[model samples]
Target: MSYLDPAIAVIDPVAAAGPYGREGTAIGFRVICVLTQEYRTPYVTQTFDPADFSEVYQHSCIDETVAFLKSRSVVAVVPGAPPSLKIVDVLAESLGLIGNPTESLEARRNKRVMKEYWTRHEVPCAAFHESGDLESVISWADGRGYPVVLKPNASVGGVHVFVCANRQEVVDAFNVIVSRADPYHQQFSTVLAEEYLDGDEYFMDLAHTGGGEAMPVAFAKYEKIQRNGNASIYKNMFSLPLDDPIALAALPYVRSVNDALGVRYGINDTEFKMTSRGPRVVEVNNRLPGASVPLMIQRCSGLNVFQENIRIFVDGRRTSGDYHFERHYNICCLINDQPGVVQGYAGLDEVRELLSYDGERMIAPQGVHWPVTRDLDGCWGLIRLVHEDREQLSRDAEAVHAMMRLLVA
Candidate 1:
């Protein structure tokens, strides 16, 4: 089914735009960016108390998504409705945009199910427990020993994930869980008390190689700076040397999980810890790396995850074999130490000058709220410096981070 012109059917709603931009990589065939009146402003429509369902009902903005896509005059369709798999599934089925049936994605979003699948496959990860009674959480972690991590399930962006050192801290974490107004949302938050493996934290971005394979693309080891019980400020560098050992240790686990889950599309961020034994899997995300990963890859390796992703989607072919990735430098100077609305930013002029020297992407805006976290979380944006020289990558990373500051009011 070839179109006379290269166009893609896209969900143009405002809410789904960011994903559409990321998903656009799949539209190597020309993309018509779209916005649905319904899907575009769903966050607003979602507020109206509808009669059919719970206090919160999923409002299907597909028709609006369709109208918007049609307006763009795309060659065909490329949807980014991860949240509404149902809508995208139907649209894909009717229009022949999606590769697999919707059933393929069911297991992709759930962590508990993924854990079970991994366990059956003998894949390695943090030891975890599931219980309603909060008191048992301490025993779960204590049994594993100190420095345990408790994560609220079904969450991204490190929300409600707590690292506890002792029994009392575990109790406090449990109390916080029991007190959540949205306990159901916390189902994954069901207190995954696990042995916290402390070591180098490596961030890996994986794309599905069209024919059902998890392909490793880019990886970085992030140094976390913690303040006030969460990762507040931080730095990240491209993982080249670090990529080797972890790639060897973690690839089998990544491949097996993809096989077990039957995921075929989209990008993912899988965070792992370098344990004394080897690299250990912590959590996997179904979306693209949130920060400057897309831009960073372009600056360093001359590879664009977006372009590669788009090529795969448009062609519906294999993408994840093996490839050589040149190294580049990227570091996020997060406003993690202070908790307040961001008033302004510093070092843009100097950073721009720095980028002029090194050739990296500078992505950040002032007068926005930037919150802090305990781990690698909440980026104000990042500074990219790219050179063939890995040593230069490190040297520039240190020099630039020292120069920038985030002012939170």
Candidate 2:
């Protein structure tokens, strides 16, 4: 690979203090990062650096952005997160590059539209309702009975996601969802109410080459705990081998969902629930998995989706069939329930001393004010553990969970 080759344009590559930033630097690629005013929040401003990219372009006007990219030696346009999906689609189509269909953009981004597309395509998914009025959503949930999920139509990382067990809970969740905008600063005009699927939740990372053909890079199960009245707060997630039964059972359904959404190229991070009725899709993201999932997958499977993404989209390489488990890996999300100024980490040293403790990221460092962990943004940090022995990995994970504490003043 030549470092002087045409650059790959990445939109909103801000997650995990710059996963794509490190990937671009390590792989010797000239990357152009497109940013919008929506990503200028305190968290992003504190963690991300525009100097890390080869070139930074502010997306103010679509015509001007398209004109600028066309003037440069740009090879491909890909989304770095959920907020950039539509822009990437538009830019890729304008540049005549490989990307998902522009007409199906809403199907890939909006939760209600995604389910509606899946239903039209006969892809198995949870029953859902979408409406802007609170009473309309409540009535739909009431008809569906208790344990319904209420969330924004277009949101990521479980933002405004709530499980409502009664009318009061639905009203509260609806109010909260409509009261504020999403991380992208987009208003929530419509709320999606979905049937809560009671089963193990799993997410699959895939690379769609072309012609509705894609390859699974990794499959992992999520262990979430209900904290602060939120039912989808991620606690821990571990990688699963390709030969694992759950992986085998969910592969076909995941592929069908990819096709239904018209994902012709680029990476897809899809979440599913293995229900008693069979595998059902929870949501599909037409981008890489959020946080450090790509790094953890590389540790376990020896395949990095970030690197493969560039190869597939820029170099026109076929998807690799060599994806398999090399080791067991788990990432435990550090949860903080206390909201105050940061005092210190109580048992961080002990956690690092564990046999399976590989690495960690302290999102909320010392002296910074922290809030109670409610959504993905409120996470204290991430601790990664890897081992050849699954049992030992589990033990170390549990120990880390017990020992680690984020002290607050």
Candidate 3:
């Protein structure tokens, strides 16, 4: 396969000190690092910055990134995170690289903006309004109905996302959200108050080839755990059959949302809640999936989302087949609800024996300080079980949850 250049530019791949920044470089792709403001604190303490990349350029401004790419004769730009998506889109636009329309970046990042655009385009979306005033937000939600969702206009992994049932809950939620700072160090003063869509929730993953076709790769139905009108835990995610009725109905809406947003090329992670009427989009992420989604997909489907994404950007290639896997898969994640220092864990040996498989983990090793679950990243780790029978998978998930425990001090 031919790549645009021997060296591809990757922007702010998590902490520069980690293996993520060197991922492409290790795989025979020359990856140049473009530093952004959101890198991890450990990276800074280690003095191991992205600038240490073999062929690196550090710039905070998007315009500067374009200039650096031009100066370095860069061919392809790969964004590593949500914040970098817009920057890379801008670079792609300015440098004539294959990517989604740069104008869509605003809608891609901001939920409020995306909902507005979707409403204007008649795309299926729950009722939403953006405002800093708690009373105004409550008024909008009151008009709609109970169980309104309040979330930061731009945040990740359901951080500070609240589902309120009444006026007091909405007031408390808005205050709590606005008090916290986002990844970009900006206060979430303006939140998006949305009518909480009641139904089954599912995520559809797609690859938008610059060639004008959006290819479906994978789909999963999520089961969320709610606490005090807040989604503090994300439980089981079951892979839906390709021919499932819900999957079939949601595909067109996914395509329509991408097209309406002027997404010509990129990976799309679109979440939809199936209402009594039909499927309505809850959120759209114009980037790769989070957590172990990529690994799980590759394990089950034999399709690597990262490699396919690279091909889309560098080779302008897109797959043209229906997505399916040979086996059924179920994934479950855990969140730390108790706040304390981590001493050790229990029930793992029994859990492994019961499940007969060791799933992927993302927990902080023992002795590390563990925080209470407040948002998505508070998740401890995940366990994915493969089963040919869907019913058996559900039974195994319950056994895992009952047996596994995260011990806290």
Best by TM-score: 2
What TM-score does candidate 1 reach? Answer: 0.73
Cα lDDT listed for each candidate: 0.55, 0.82, 0.72
Instruction: Estimate, for each residue in 162-274, the C-alpha lDDT of model 3 and write its tens digit.
Output: 88988899898899888987544547778788887878889989887766557778888988888876664678788877667887878888888877777777666898888
C-alpha lDDT (0 to 100) for residue 198 of candidate 3: 77
What is the number of backbone collisions in each predicted candidate, taken in the order shown? 22, 0, 0
lDDT of 2 by residue, 327-400 (tens): 98889888888899988887889998999888987778778889888777677888999888888888998998
Q: Who wins the lDDT comparison?
A: 2
Report the C-alpha displacement of residue 44, candidate 2, in angstroms.
4.5
Q: By the lDDT metric, which is better: model 2 or model 3?
A: 2
Off by over 4 Å in 1: 1-106, 174-189, 212-214, 231-234, 241-245, 318-322, 355-377
User: Candidate 3: minimum summed lDDT over ten consecutive residues — where?
Assistant: 40-49
TM-score of 2: 0.95
User: How large is the C-alpha RMSD of every model relative to the true structure?
Assistant: 6.9, 1.9, 3.5
